[model samples]
Target: MPRPEDSVWAVSVAQVASRPGQSKPIDTVFPAPAGIGDSVVGVREGADIRVVGSFDSIVDGLVFTGRFEAPVTAECTRCLKPIDPDWTVPVTAFFPYDSGACRDDRRTGHGKDDVEIVAGEDESEDVYPLSPDGAFADMESLLRDTLVEALPLQPLCREDCLGLCPQCGADLNEDPDHHHDVTDIRFAALEQLKAQLEAEQTGR
Candidate 1:
């Protein structure tokens, strides 16, 4: 069977221009693309990113909101053991297309001399961007960023991970009592002197 993430989900703005206030179902799989790195925000590569949502044409732009889920495979932060877990989260984003007329309509009430400005930071930061020429609204960048952002910074296999032994590099979960004979750095010179004396006495 074809994995859900193997296909790209792109919608042309032209297709939805005629319809307003209508919701279109968006369900597809986002395959791991090349050069996107194996570990996105937190999701591992090759895992399928399932996107299920709808697209609607609002006044100024299009809005996409849906639930996204994927299986995650990564090494445990503490023990370095393989960890496979399911990652799921809800995603909501807006994509603004060439809507200069829409903005003008929204600003109609304001005085002619009054200029409209973006409420805060660059408007693009909050909403995804569609093609300037009103061609297609690409979902690749949004999916990559949303999935990555949903991943935990440090994923653990279990709550109480025993981790690994600092001395012998052994898994503490398996060998909790594993240890090694450690020499104190402060006594290094004395131990070297004692070894030299013992060698001289044996030679004599």
Candidate 2:
């Protein structure tokens, strides 16, 4: 039985470049930021993170792909109230092979999406820690960054979700009389006319 705080995983960070098909879990919550070039942004995630990823070498950095799961007790986007959503996110990222890119991409005003930050002197380091142990294995930052990437730009429960009824404040799904089906009165009158015509022809 490993205590939450005492849990630390051993990874083969340096060998990712040479040996393929390697992966590990960086389990912990920390702080960090997101972005690389001109557009960079802040990053954050749950207190604890569970990262399951496979890392291989790339020209720029270690290419990693996997899923991260954590207890996300955040407010519902609709209600703006607390709603626990066990958010499990799948991710794909490139851990800068060299920290040089992280340092080079430290300029501001490159546009929000134009730049990214791996590790810089600015911002909370806890939010975006290292990735690999010897190579900057900040599982915390990785989880947060991947989460930001995975988040839906326009999140919704459904495409056509009729949210809580504005009138009686009821969930449309729960309320039977929420959206009533209406028949046209003109059509009903025409049916009666047709019936009368048929009755006259039958002389009944």
Candidate 3:
């Protein structure tokens, strides 16, 4: 295991392939970097993300299957009220120890540079990378990407949130019955004509 301060989410995988039948159980927590919140709406910077699961040896490399949970803090999309929510994200990733094998395999059509995969690309590029010597696997990048993708485009406090009053910018959830008496612009001519007739009839 890497030091919590230096490589908070990196796990050593040097012995996994040798122990084929064993699966390394993983349970760790790390303070997410402050930059993580810039891409996500509800996530707080420096929040704790708890990862729990295991890495099992496959044929060539290893598979990291885990789940993570973190606190999400953001305003409700409908009412703009501050809210605290929790997100549980499931992660299933494969990191090959020797990416060169894939490059040589005719079926994979991957090149030598395929080992250094980019984020948010096709499934072909989704594989995490192991160190050249296969000593450790860094999970910080993968976890941050997963957490960002897990956020909803518009987070809501509740399914039945009443939202806010458009006219006064008041939270409608607090006063569900509140409303504005706005007349339709199409009826403005009719309303003005009725007012004029009433004024003439009253000799005003």
> Model-by-model lDDT, in order?
0.66, 0.48, 0.73
Which pairs of residues collide in candidate 1? Answer: 4-29, 5-29, 5-30, 5-31, 41-148
Judge candidate 1 at residue 112 and give its lDDT.
28
My TM-score estimates for the predictions, one after another, are 0.67, 0.45, 0.81
Q: List model 3 lDDT by residue over 1-204, tens digit each.
A: 744335766787777854555688989887775545543265666688898989887655677888988888767789887777778999888777666565554255444343333222225434778766777888877877787777778878899999988899998888888988899999999999999999999995
Q: Candidates 2 and 3: which is better by TM-score?
A: 3
Q: Pick the winner on TM-score between candidates 1 and 2.
A: 1
Report the C-alpha lDDT of model 1 over 1-204, residue by residue, as the tens digit. Answer: 643233365665566743657677877787654333344224655558788888877645667778887776677778888876777789777765545554664457442221222222135454677766555667777777766666676778898998988877898888777888999999999999999999999999
TM-score of candidate 3 to 2 decimals: 0.81
Evaluated at residue 151, the lDDT of candidate 3 is: 74
Best by lDDT: 3
lDDT of 2 by residue, 1-204 (tens): 633233243244665543335554444333332231111211232145566656655434555667777554343334333434457777765555445554555445332232333332234332322343435444544554556665544334445545566545667645646764667787998889999999999996
Q: Count steric clashes of candidate 2.
A: 25
- Best TM-score goes to which candidate? 3
